[model samples]
Target: MEQDWTAVGDALRARLDELGMTMTDLATKSGVSLTTVRELVHVLNTRRRQPRTLASLSAALGWPGEHLGSVLRGRPTSEPSGFGSLASVHSELQDLRQRVEALERAVRRTD
Candidate 1:
């Protein structure tokens, strides 16, 4: 079955919103370019087929990279291994740390 890119983008956007993040924030966190992040968020046709890009985004989003890649490639992903929430918590913590660091940087700059 063909993968629905629109659905993929919608899901990703929803996840970002749930995490209180923007596409630029996701790009910075995932080490993906802003353009690529924008394209992915908007479901625009772009050359975002690189495995590393997908892997980076998945890792940043706290999703299984392999499963995300499979879905992006229009392949079947296996059932969850029951660690979804744990991973999400971990990701949230990481995001918080990053946010703290950014705030610290801003404070130092003002000093």
Candidate 2:
């Protein structure tokens, strides 16, 4: 099923408001680029986002990344019972991956 990008944008905007966060803040906290965050929340762009991008954003928002990813991908967002711990582990792993990638980029810049 085709995902509703506008709805996704609206949901993101609502979450941002609830969190008292600006787009720039979300970008910085999520480790996502400002341009990507703007595009995601601006409602005019229909471009699909990468799974890792959604995962990073969800993790920053203190949400389960897989649930957010499922919603974005138009899949059912339900998880089986006892999956919460796994989701938490997944989010932590994603965070670690992001840190590693950032470090790798910084090291590359020094090369």
Candidate 3:
């Protein structure tokens, strides 16, 4: 099926609003470059992104890992029952990863 990049962009923008997150925040949290995040949020570039990038953004938004991928594929997104717990765990892991990266950077500066 041909994908709908525009719909993906709109959905991403709305999700960011719902989360009270700026594009930069999404980029940082998702580990995606700010320019790519901006492009997606603004619909400035409709080119498809890597699956990993879409999954990262979706995960950062507290969505199922394949939510954005499904959106891009023009399919209805269905969350499996009890997905909330898994999403929460994913969120916690992302937070821990960011913290570890920060700590590593701090240690590197002191070296």
Candidate 4:
């Protein structure tokens, strides 16, 4: 099967937007490096990623573990089923926490 790096990048970017998450957030959440996340998000690398890398990203994105792998292989995968509202609430809380942390850091820096 052929791999479509562009599709992977598009999906990653779109998911990040949909989650209102920055690439840094994804890297932290996925335990993946920011550099790798940037490469994937920007499609800077056309090389195939390890299954574990894709799985980590998928999990961090609140998707099925194989979601990204499927995309890489040009297979169709659906958005996560069930617990959508719960997941959204969780994601929102996480985003809010990150914002608060950033604000706190800014305040600290100004002091």
Candidate 5:
């Protein structure tokens, strides 16, 4: 069965409305690009699901990371279990990148 993206976008848009949020707010809160949020809103309106779409949506909504996994993948994996929100993931990713860079520099110095 094919999932309709437009409907999904619409439903997601409605959910945002119910929560008193605008696309701009979602973009800011989720740490995603405005364009991505716009596209997801469109897809949700059309009831279609994309790869990692659920993760993005859940993160934006401040809901659990696995919130929409069931709908999109039929089940959620326990892996990457702490997707509290995009802000958290973005923050953590930045920290990780910095640590990796530091490690790389140390390795180069010792080589």
Candidate 6:
């Protein structure tokens, strides 16, 4: 395929046109740089936009809350903050498996 820019960049570009705005217009309205706007379009076109790009695009478009996640970032949505947590302290998931089996056995005996 010719890398369907339609699904991404073209769509955004169309929206901008419909709103009577160029990339320059968006940059002017949002107080962002033209270079940043171009980079956002490029990345989104290539399916490489990051969270930071979405944030910038969102702010520029005045999108709030969960906007620009799937549209610009190619994901279902995003968290307001990172959700990663440290895995169990000194307790690998694999290590817990055997221990859990043993505990289950003990509980069964007591029942």
**lDDT, each prediction:** 0.77, 0.74, 0.85, 0.88, 0.62, 0.53
Q: Could you give candidate 4's per-residue lDDT for residues 1-111 as a string of tens digits?
A: 799888999999988898878999899999999999999989998786789999999889888899999999999987645654566678889878988999999999999
Rank by TM-score, highest first.
4, 1, 3, 2, 5, 6
Tens-place lDDT per residue, model 2, 3-98, is: 777766876787677665688878998899998889888866777677898888777665667656676667776656756556456546766899
Worst 10 residues of 3 by lDDT: 82-91
Q: Which sequence of candidate numbers ranks them by lDDT, best first? A: 4, 3, 1, 2, 5, 6
**Steric clash pairs (candidate 2):** none
Best by TM-score: 4
lDDT of 6 by residue, 1-111 (tens): 233333456544654654445788667655667876775556433544455655555555544433555554344544344221211222234346867999999999999
- TM per prediction: 0.74, 0.63, 0.71, 0.79, 0.49, 0.43
Better candidate number, 3 or 4, judged by TM-score: 4
Clash totals for all models, in order?
Answer: 0, 0, 0, 0, 22, 0
Residue 86: error of model 3 in Å?
Answer: 9.9
lDDT of 5 at 31: 71
TM-score of 5: 0.49
What is the TM-score of candidate 3?
0.71
Model 1 lDDT per residue over 1-111, tens place: 456666667767887887777888789888999988888789887454788887888878777776567766677766478566776687679878988999999999999
| Candidate 3 C-alpha error for residue 58, in Å | 0.2
